[model samples]
Target: MTVEDPLFATPSSEDIERTMDILGENGVSLVHLQFSDIAGGGRTVSIPTALLPRVFRRGFRFDGSAMSGGMRQVEVDLFLMPDPSTLVVLPPLPDRPRRAFIYCWVTRRGGQPFAGDPRTILQKQLNRASAIGLDYRVGIELEFYLYKGESLATASFESPHVSPSYFSDSDVGTALVRDHIVAWTHELGLGVHGAHHETGPGQQEIDLRHLGGIRIADQLNSTRQLIRVIAEQHNMKVTFMAKPFDDAPGSGMHLFQRLLKLDDGTDLLRGEDGADISAIAGHMIAGQIRHASAMSAILNTTVNSYKRLADGHRAPAWATWARVSESSLLRVPSTPEGTLTDIELRSPDPMANPYLAIAVALGAAVDGIEQKLDPPGAFDENLVHYNEEEFARFGVEQLPQTLGEAITNLTHDDTMREILGHFIVDQLLTVKRAEWDAYRRHVSPWEHIQYGEL
Candidate 1:
């Protein structure tokens, strides 16, 4: 029993109609429409080419039972309204079928956005920025590890240098795989600034160029999917879990952001008066710092993620900012005169739902701008090596040490509940709390080893 609202007009009618002509001419018979579940997991629905016009003009409906993650008390029909702009001629892959697919906006039967939808949630926050004549362009640096073949988190190796700038003869096979991946990335119109080996064994970093609005989040999802397909083709496996191996450096998804004038495309952070630091930029930083801990539950998103956020892991261990410190939660890497964007948020791991992550961040930033919040004095040094005593002396606060802690922080932040709907927030609490409870109940090998001696 589902119905489309009369006002729920299909998006970009002309563009989709035109694209379908090309798709039909190219002999494309199937399309996979993709959307994110509440946790940012990618889900898809395959539609025949014949249904393209109807699906685009109306929407695709599916049972909510499978993908809802228990958010709904009863199974209901959910609609996916495809984003025509994301229609891509997906090149054939060995494992996947030859088809074109588009990302989508999740909606309810009445044509209203589903409250738990990540993309819709993000769009709401961005709309807040848009209302004020502001916009954000985001650049993503995602790190993941390549394992030998079908490996588990327990696997470990002797390691490479704790450096990202070096690549050796040992990187040949991985490099070739990455080369093919990068080529396909370009083919799909997801351009990359760089792809290279990172500090840990078989770790790699791929930097996606800055994109505006929901497009970057959509592309981030596509890129992660692409990485897996490419890895499987080469008989290698990849892990985006923040810390898979205890001994190795944790992987992170560093976000670089800039505020822009929506109409004129001016870099507002540079300021009208051309001050060294704009009030907007300071407030943005202050806003992000204010919300960092609560946002961690969404950005980090896993029990293993906290391990990556630990000290000495080249990840942000504390809620701190610096002009250029790599180890702080927020780092402004450049200035108004510099060639690069100034603000980089370093705490998010690859496990996060990019949509929710960016939404909370942007929401917090918008709050900062609205409140005219002032940032604290900067903590200029690399705090990765700093102990708690040193942190107190410098007045920096540590991020949550565990998933449980992160959940607690999230509960206290009404801003997160307000920004991300209560439906999503409550769903996360239900799921993550269960996970933490299960972890607490389970017995590990360490317990056996220690208690056996006792």
Candidate 2:
């Protein structure tokens, strides 16, 4: 079914009226119709109040090729249909008034869902789960670093701690930015489970409640945007960079995934009779571990991402699963019997695209179910000791060590390339290669200091 005509029941007339009332009450001057490109970057075109109804009924059309990795030049004309349920009063800038934001899905001219669209990719994964009589529930854990001021350059790594504990008084600059982020996140209708000051001086994390992938992905993208906006308001800066500062911990995009079967709405990962996990749960983890090497390019894409992949930085240098270990690539959380049991993919960095991240993860899990794969033995000791020989024996392989190697792995893996499609794969390679070329030419302080006098 098309996104506009969801197989599920539509929102009631009363709900529509209430949404209109809310929009009017909020004094929203314009509506920002937003959708994600294939790279999971936000792209939008604003419409004034007078044009919203007409556009809402007929939807809006634009050239699909203009969107990065969306479509080829020959096949253009993408359509956008907004979700009324997603209407929210957008947080305004210093000089701007309130505006509403509605998430949209892209489609072809005849109203078919665009295959190259990242959102559609995720929707297909969700639909596939439905076909198997399973429902997927996801929760995202967002980690980010807060910087001193609104600038591209990072603070020196040697700086002392300027931020306090979550509840304690922080330095003036950090406290002001954190408060703004927390307040605006709540104001934007995000169900922020909690916000806290991380261990590092300028690091922070916000936990979000469990929700479906569609909305949660939207929230993830918007949350990143919110951090920057709110930080700017306080004259500070925020980064989702995986490894911005050389010596500090990097940000991660951790997802908790659970499956519920439609037959009787039972959590598939839980066992009713015993303490052991369900067979299906074991298989799912197995799939993730099996595909972990191929999936690394998507999970940890940026050049700096590998900087955080070293031992002791909380980056999973090894491909392993665990029931309770937070350091594993896939963590199966321990929960009470009869409650939802989930496996968390912990390798994704904050810089990864939310839609692509979710798509790869869900696709891997679904593969697990279809193949009936069983997870390998779990590890209690640290995984960093596994060298190439040991990793091969354990069926574990080190992730790509550099962006160049990552691109090669991603391009060569037929499964990942087939799943992601050529458009996305090619575009990602082109973009990242350019970034590498630019970075390779740079003479950084590390290089200068190490070689200048010697």
Candidate 3:
């Protein structure tokens, strides 16, 4: 029983011993073996701390059929082998039992990797990049909303205006939540750049410093869980829904990505002039733009996701790139002298599986570089406000307008299907199509009000 992927390198006996020592010293009573499903949902199976040594050697087995995404009842047995590097001790919060968490690699009973596992899918993509002498760094700007409960109408913190309330000190609730998140993130060893209030009422954003692809994905997943736990502690509810309210701005999980050379840690996207973007960067952006429509399926991932892409919400709705406009799908920020340059992809919501979303994205960029695709001219203006003639003149086109449309694009695109294998793509399409069908059949209040009387 051997598994040999650089991303899933088996933990050495010494390394496992050291981690066990830390858990024992911290009085950790439970260990959470966590993994993500194909639909971006987190699933976990907890084990008593006494089984740590057995887990390190043989791994824990679970029923895969009970989980969302792939395995059926006939092929249900799967194993979770913990990754030692991802171990994080729970903060000593009052009334909460001491526990440690670690992410795991999904494998079959015989120790072969599970292709249907979202984390494994991501690692395969990373392996492809590594084979080419390249690696990637990712930073996330995650926006979410705090509400009283299931009611979207009641914000936890009330504000009247829609103007950008970047960091107003007047809201005590927001301040407390933000501070707690920052502190807890720091305690968990996930570097936090900052947190602040966003434009929508009760909306907030957290910026994480850049890290390697796998590490950042793990942190983002953990951060989402932690936010929910902290929100409950304060007797509030937090949602990463793309568009929680029709009239308010949508929350987005904006991704900042940069590619680097594996050998010397040099940024491959930085131009020699220090002021211009490198050719490789252009190709990457071009790749993103070319595949923007298909990529939306994974990036946005929900029926409600389309609601956030309305004309005036600051979300990017078109497949275009720009030098600095927030309205563009890809925004290339001005690189300060001697600083690294990166691209910001604005379509993803927090609902997506960070692992799969980033893997597909980087895979597309690699495709563009290999084919040497040239990008269109950068659109430096607000695309949402563009007229038909202007849009045609700029060669800009709107992204897929609905979940169905996005799925169609995803199914038809050979590149995306290749990056995410036929099996994974088939499973995703099946799940999303069912979701779309269910939504289509349901009648909403808006529909009832508009046409039910007729």
Candidate 4:
């Protein structure tokens, strides 16, 4: 099956052979084929070096029933087509010098892209961007929490081991880990823009240079995988859990997105003259606002995600856009000239699939542009302070307060079904419903405390 050369142009067979030769020369013993499930966890299958060639040509088979949301039971043959461009040596598992990791594309029996695959969904959205004669570029700022692995037993998260400082002189106790993160990120060919301690203790942020379309998603997935793997090797446990500790700040995967027109390198997002952004940008923002409730399921894809949406945390409460307001859902950074003016979405947690998150953001923006939707005025004041009257005046609506609520909104939105395929939408709801149902059945410490002996 011949697929278009858009998000991923299948490389020539020679390219694949060349990559294999390099890996062989480097003494890579085992090839770990990796793919992402719907929930963004790394799924892997290891095959011997001897079978690498056959695996590359014919692809390898796996039990679809076992993987999450990617496949269903009843003998559906799934293929793992390795992308040669994603080959990188696993730093954490250096002992297996011959073991390398490569990202795989999930395909069905007749060589069709799996509709439920988040990676493929993002690619489809990028293809949509191409059809509109615009290129979607995304830069990512990834935040994570670092904790002492053994301290989980009895550690007071109220007081962190480190303080918030963008570039303070004091070293965070996890400086070594942060430095290691930088080194490995560079080694893996990601353009490391910067890394520093965030406003919260034990929380660190790493920014990657902007890349066009699917590369942004690829970098995010690979970077997260590398970050966790490296942290584990250092005898520490790292979490991207949105709100891992109650008193601590939540970790967010902020995506900075911009649209560039293909013709003459003109940015469709901003106007040519020295003024406000072009009409396309306005419409895109409008589309995002129109579908805020629906998009929440993808952005905040976990039960714990709602914890960040409440006041005090940086999570966006309203679907407003602003060049100055950081509290807005779509924050336009006011950087100096020549720098890209991008939209910063604060809703996404590090736990969600980066590809799906980006896809949903872009897809909603595309809808707005297509419909020429008008965005409301900027909310300069803190949305948390808005009273019922003020909120009603400004058309401010609160984000989904829980996973179940988000899913309910998503289920009714036709735009979500159009952007994310029906299959994917169904799969996401199915998995998340199971999660919510399981969570409801569990007895919690809070429950016990609330009515222990009333």
Number of the top lDDT candidate: 3
Off by over 4 Å in 3: 5-7, 153-164
Candidate 3 local distance difference test against the native: 0.85
**TM-score for each candidate, following the candidate numbering:** 0.92, 0.89, 0.96, 0.93
What is candidate 4's lDDT per residue for 1-454, written digit by digit as tens? 4333354555577977888797878777788888878777778898877787776767777766444654555436777777887787765355545578787877766456777667888888888988988788888889887766465445332235545565553654557778888998898787777888776666789898889756777777778877787777766677788887777778888888888886666667765677667778888888888888889999999988888777377678777877776777888777667866677777788888888888889999999998999888877666667776887787777778889999999999998898899987888899999998998899999889999999
Worst 10 residues of 3 by lDDT: 155-164
User: Highest TM-score among the candidates is held by which one?
Assistant: 3
Q: How close is candidate 4 to the true structure, as a TM-score?
A: 0.93
Which digits, one per residue and each the tens of the lDDT, describe model 2 over residues 152-176?
3645321355435444455556666
Residue by residue across 204-228, what tens digits does model 3's lDDT show? 9999889988889999988888999
Error of 4 at 267 (Å): 1.9
In model 4, the runs with Cα more than 4 Å from the true position are 1-10, 69-75, 92-94, 151-166, 272-274
Clashing pairs in 4: 28-98, 29-98
lDDT of 1 by residue, 134-207 (tens): 98889999999877744664453323443333454366667777787789889889867788878777788899
User: Candidate 3 or 4, higher lDDT?
Assistant: 3
Off by over 4 Å in 1: 1-9, 94-96, 153-169, 271-276, 335-340
- Per-candidate Cα RMSD to the true structure, in Å, reads 2.9, 3.2, 1.9, 2.5
Model 2: CA > 4 A from native: 1-18, 69-71, 91-94, 150-176, 385-388, 437-445
